[model samples]
Target: MDIATYTAFCLTAGPLTILMVIGLWKLFEKAGRPGWESLIPVYNVYIILKISGRPWWLLLLLLIPGINIIIGVGVAVDFIKSYGKFKISQNAAIILLPFICLPKWGFDKNTRYLGPSATISFHEKHRKDLQKSTTREWAEAVIFAVVAATLIRSLFIEAYTIPTPSMESSLLVGDFLFVSKINYGARLPITPVAFPFAHHTMPIIGGKAYWNGIKLPYFRLPGLGDIKKGDVVVFNFPMDADSPFYRPVDKRENYIKRCQGTPGDTLSLLNAKVYVNDEAAITPSHGEMEYMVRNDGSSFNRQLARDLHLSDIQQFTNQDFMMNMTAQSAALLKQQAGIKSVRPNIRFNGVYDPEVFPHNPKFRWNVDNLGPIIIPKKGWTVKLDSLTLPIYRRAIEVYEQNKLQVNDNHISINGKPADSYTFKLNYYWMMGDNRHNSEDSRFWGFVPEDHIVGKALFVWMSWDAETHKIRWSRVMRMIK
Candidate 1:
């Protein structure tokens, strides 16, 4: 839990509840004398209408705000006529009575009246009606349900609309997706400003200065082994978590298309084919580059969409077929739709290296090519002169020089205690299944495992650009 999270909770629950209360009060006009007496909880005896010489139990109407105003005026009129003691009759109370008291109606304390003990018979007849004024109850229920549901959704599963083609052919713009918070194990609620000075993250200063700042209960860890190669996954955007815009956690804007290159394996994409540890990757050909999933896409998506239809399939014609998004949003959508990743699990020969190994083989790598580098682990150690690169050196500096500060003793990376510190978080190599089209780890480098969100379980729906129809059959189909 952090300061921002707690503030959101209070804004939703506390102040809103109080506003509902005051709103109800303003309805019945009970702020001011005689029938104004209905505002007294115990004195009203659960049936406050008799005090105004009208039907009993209009008190329930007092629970409603807008309608309460109409009823309050009616009740004030009826009570005045019943009071022979005061010259202020029903109509007189509504008009001239304002000259004396500002409220000019019921619920005022200063005014006094002697009204007839009438309406006992009317109260008895409509007792059941008074008990159930469904209109008021239903209105109140609707207001509360909407408020409660919004709170749950904001904190639990937030719904996002995809906006680009990078992850295209999979996630489309206007395609609504729900990202679950608990999927990556959410942080426990911590009071934002508990201890002071230590959690000193005040306005002008960045977050570092607090004592009891941003603490979590440290519950169960996120699940392991769920994310596999070729499985679409979402994660927090690495470069800009602190920006004013809380960007999508998915790798398109923050999400991307990348082939999974496993630990200890050398991988690369030369020309247009993918290679994992010097072996060619087996890919699923999804036909030509017409529109996949949906038919109603731009001018470019029509060809493949029709081919995938394979003739017998029905055509889609609904407006839901195409997503019209802003330029920025469209970029994100395109990335999501761009390529389909295939898990690297089989053994095959490299496209360039002709020396094939029947069982296991090894070969050299290039700039457009890669591999032979070992996955750095918790206990791994290396001689600075023996094996050194800019990336490796940077990692060492982060783990040893910046993160670890031991008193006259060497530090460690991750949990592997050692005289020679090593890798901190688990790391992985990611690349686009579309060899030439993706910008990935081969360029920016390895991804840390702590950023993982969840394996994309399924392709929920597809839109056809040509026919402009939504394909219902694809909904809920497991990703291959």
Candidate 2:
């Protein structure tokens, strides 16, 4: 975590934690237990379980990350009920405003220690008041399910579907994926207030699903490891911050791509081949690119196209054609009857593509050929000048939330003239495996760490839309 995020967490959570401890101390004394017991960490939870009549085994679940949240809520509700408080609003107060409600109940003159609420004898004694109607029971069940599912989705794994061909043969369209948030560490909700099960927009309502008024600083729990090259990642689109859509960081559209360049690495593309730190990067085995195919003036069989999984086939003439397919498929097609030659459709170096990253004519970069520019790392400083400004401007000014100005070739950041600037957050370069057909980091620039969502783990299901059948071979396929 960065210094700013750590400081923000300390400011907000530190005080609430202290207040809850104090309230628990008073409530323990009322239950005929030592007040100082609340000062201990694990023992305090055991004490609460004992008072609430819950099993001591629940302490093991409390040690878990995602499941702990749900168990904690249940314990809080039962603890409040042991004090003769069973109203729906009262339970909500204890769960949501524990610091205030716990202290209020502890000092209240009417509040008295009742028997353990989770015990069978206690429920029988207060059966008349505690009995719930059929409708109320169903309502509570639905609420609990929603809360549990939301917590699991936020902190553990989430289901995502491949809606685009960006990842192509590696991860096909209609692939249902289980993206693991734990791989890169689960990011806490930046926009906490949102409609359940909805992403950025409400279903069939055509409006924002989240409120941006209560935004939180970016923070993540400890993860398995840092992001490595070649990992498939899903992140919020950085371009959503421009033009008509000024979305909150978390609310931006999600885009999945393979990590081509990590922090502190120099990345470039030479003739459609990715080179990282001057070494040829590992390419996906099933990755596809456009290939120019020449035939002996004979049309290809339909079965050949299906077998090759060829797409975007364009015929320039009777003997000349262009198609998107994997290298293995191209090699297979080359040996077919009446096939003449197959060559890669590559944009030559020094050919400028205005739509490419940096988007400047001076760079002369294209999808096939790009620069050896360095990816930004945390605390990595770069000179602020004409050539570098266009590359890092979006990351520095927009992503880092700094006010930048340029006057007569002089760079000023936050009202101070500067010749160089250091990055606060690491930035990555993401690109699609479908080199020619994908709109990825080649068009945009860098993906800030804050935009990262999770890593795509595996495909649970795969459906071929045109064939209207499930791809059985792709089911339960682990993504590389």
Write the residue-wise lDDT of candidate 2 on 1-480 in tens digits: 547667977898889888889888888988999999999989998999899888999999988766677889999898878887877789889977998888788778788778675346666877897789999999889887888898888889999999988888899999999999988888889999899999989999789999998778887877789999999999999999987988999899999999999999999999999999999999999999999999999877779999899999999999999999999999999999998999999999999999999999979999999998999999999999999999998898999988899999999998999999999999999999888889899999999998999999999999999999999999999998
TM-scores of the candidates are 0.40, 0.92
Cα deviation of 216, candidate 2, in Å: 1.4
TM-score of 2: 0.92
Worst 10 residues of 1 by lDDT: 286-295
lDDT of 1 by residue, 1-480 (tens): 224545766666566445433432432443233444445563543333554556566766855533444466556555544332233233443433333332333334544444345344444666686564678568657644653454343234444444544443445434545554444443222333232322223447554333343333222233334445565555434433335532222211335444365544555645334566677865423211211224233333445433332221223443223222223333333454532321211223343332221111233332244444544544456543323333454445432223333334443443444444445445556654333233456555555554444444455666555468876766665544
Question: Over 4 Å off in model 1, which ranges?
Answer: 1-161, 170-226, 241-259, 263-265, 270-272, 277-281, 284-368, 372-375, 382-387, 393-421, 463-468
Off by over 4 Å in 2: 1-26, 32-47, 53-63, 115-121
Alpha carbon lDDT of residue 409, candidate 1? 45
RMSD to native, candidate 2: 2.5
